[model samples]
Target: MTCPLIQKDLANACALETVKKIVAEIGDGIFCVLVDESGDCSNKEHMVVVVRFIDGRGFVVERFIRIVHVPNISATGLKKALETLLSGLGLCISKIRGQGYDGASNMRGHLGCLKTLIKKREPQAYYVHCFAHQPLLALVSIARNHEDVDWFFCEINRLVTFIRSFNKRQDLLCKKQVSHFADLIENELMETGTWLNQELSIARANDTLWGSYFRILTRLVWLFTPIVELLEDLNSD
Candidate 1:
């Protein structure tokens, strides 16, 4: 009673049915998407798309669904890649509630293409600029605009480079630590770079403007004077 074509069709139908069951179980909820594109050393741009949502069990989870390699960054290419990804995965665009990007012009531009294409299809897709990245951008702008502030960053980099370059300098830094030197540095500097947008602003404003800068600068001056003096002596010689 089973025709081969009918049997094959039934198998495919069951597969889709299973997918539908899962989606239904997941129910209605807002889903957040993060998309980024980057070029490798080979100059191939790869787009990665991830989804975050409350799953059937009511736990928030982020799942990476696709990493697609694209040859170019044109609007047409990006649109096609997205459409193909959604169609292949049986994902509905209407279900998308939030979109996030790293402020790439192509991703957020009013007419630069990608945003235009997406808005045409899913007008309700709300876009949010990555807040962490925005802070870094603000810092970069402040640094570039002020000369003294720029000098501060250069100095900080020089100091960091000196310590990182030689074991002796690193040991000296470790010895001067009130607690574990590594822990101190990690606590103060590791997450600092994530706020790159405010870096220049923090550097330029006078010591009186932000009292915290003095504390940070004092630490740098204490830890780095020996290395700086040595370098100066070498230059003079």
Candidate 2:
């Protein structure tokens, strides 16, 4: 009880005072809310809420108010928590002109999503998806719309996986890299034991991350010689 009171209670009290000051400065101003949920190494769910509003000088400012530990995340729980947080700071739900989510799969679902629930509580709070995902979505769209591009990615992804799974192939790849480096040194192209920043392993591409294809292509370019020799060695084995 002593430890929790000192660490948690005292800390929360200080945070509350700071929020009160910030809210007082934004009196009667319309603000937007940004919400993101994350989990730490202990698998504890945490919700972060930020408020973006125009200050007295007409400049926009964003301030992070609270990070609450939640055992689970649900539409109702999130909405209630958000309401309580704002009300604790003497803010009105109607002042929330917008709401934003990370556009993650869990939050994007049709049923009981955070953005949807938020709008239900405050109809004026418009939903805005994260802009960072636009490029990723474009890549996914291109892959889905084009058969050739899709097949190309699938084949490269499988090839990288297969190479990584085989110990002999990985050793052969390192050997080829060593041999190539030796030649470069012998030819005075680079210093002996020159370390190329690129590692020998083939890079794996994530299906959901944006620009992973570029990563695959870049790795292929750097390891072209060693990869070719490795393939030939595997064939002769």
Model 2 compared with the native: what TM-score? 0.58
TM-score of each model, in listed order:
0.49, 0.58
lDDT (tens digit, per residue) of candidate 2 on 12-99: 8888789988898779989998887888999898889889899989999989889987666877777777888889788998899988
Candidate 2 wrong stretches, greater than 4 Å: 1-17, 139-149, 155-237
**Candidate 1, 1-237: lDDT as tens digits:** 389999999987876676565455445666767787889899889998777678877888776666789877776787788778766666676777777776566877768567667767788877787665676667677766899987876676565565567766455444444233345456784333454312111122232224454655766555454445545654686
**Number of residue pairs clashing in candidate 1, backbone atoms closer than 3 angstroms, sequence gap of 3 or more or interchain:** 6
Which run of 10 residues does model 1 get worst, by summed lDDT? 197-206
TM-score of 1: 0.49
Predictions in order: lDDT: 0.64, 0.79
For model 2, what is the error of residue 19's alpha carbon versus the real structure, in angstroms, after optimal superposition? 2.5
